[model samples]
Target: MPTTEITHALLAPGESELIEVAGNRIRIIVANPTLLVCDYSAAPHFPGPPLHVHPGFDETYIVLEGRLEVTVAEERRELAPSAAAYVSGSVPHTFDNPGAERARFLSICSPGGFEDFFRAMATGDREAIVGVSERFGYEAVKTRG
Candidate 1:
């Protein structure tokens, strides 16, 4: 195994680097080998990423403002302010903003590197996004209409 460096990160609101993907803005708060933290903002009625499974990392979402509909596996629930949800690795999950106002939240992934995947998708190329997601052990599942 290789050694990894651990560094400290301090980001005030609007200070982190923001990347846009599929109409959502994601600010990378931390992107180290052990953990990845991101501040996400989505427009109203935004359908988030496709239902996907991460085979190498667990993800947790902390809702900061507005409401979000989070679906894990086959279950779904609405989260309000200050609410949180956790999805373990290999679980299919996705989230969406169902409120009329913009939604903001913190998304944390363990055993970090998901930020890189998001960055690749920021280019808005479908093929590139799929390739990067596959490289990161992410599998997208087909959702029902």
Candidate 2:
């Protein structure tokens, strides 16, 4: 079992960097070979980016506080506190927070590496995500996974 607090040997602090994307503060907590956990905080009306799909790792979103607008393929749902959703790998999905309060959520990715993509976004580069799909064992394909 893991220790009570993630110590120095487990993972370094700088290893988990915070990336700011579109007025949202995204912090990568855990990034490993098979699991990835990221914490995201978005101000009210923070519009998410375009819909994208990953062909390798599936994703799960756990809303810690506030509300979120999530779109899995063609279906859209409003998620609140303690609410969660799953999107299989290679599915087109996106999310946004339109409420007045700060929306906080945890994103989990199986087979890891989502943080690389977010880090690229933090650089404020528009085209960084283009090569992300290929770099992180995921293809930016249009197929539903």
Best by TM-score: 1
Candidate 2: TM-score? 0.78
Determine the backbone clash count of candidate 2: 0
Predicted structure 1: lDDT: 0.86
Off by over 4 Å in 1: 1-4, 125-128
Candidate 1, which ten residues in sequence have the lowest lDDT sum?
Answer: 136-145
* All candidates: CA RMSD (Å): 2.1, 5.7
Please provide, for model 2 over 25-125, each residue's C-alpha lDDT reduced to its tens digit, 9 standing for 90 to 100.
Answer: 88888877678888889878987756777777888999999999998889999999999999986777888898999999999999777787887777855
Record all residue pairs in model 2 with backbone atoms less than 3 Å apart, i.e. clashing.
none
TM-score of each: 0.88, 0.78
What lDDT does the true structure give each of the candidates?
Answer: 0.86, 0.80
lDDT of 2 at 137: 49
How many residue pairs clash in model 1?
A: 0
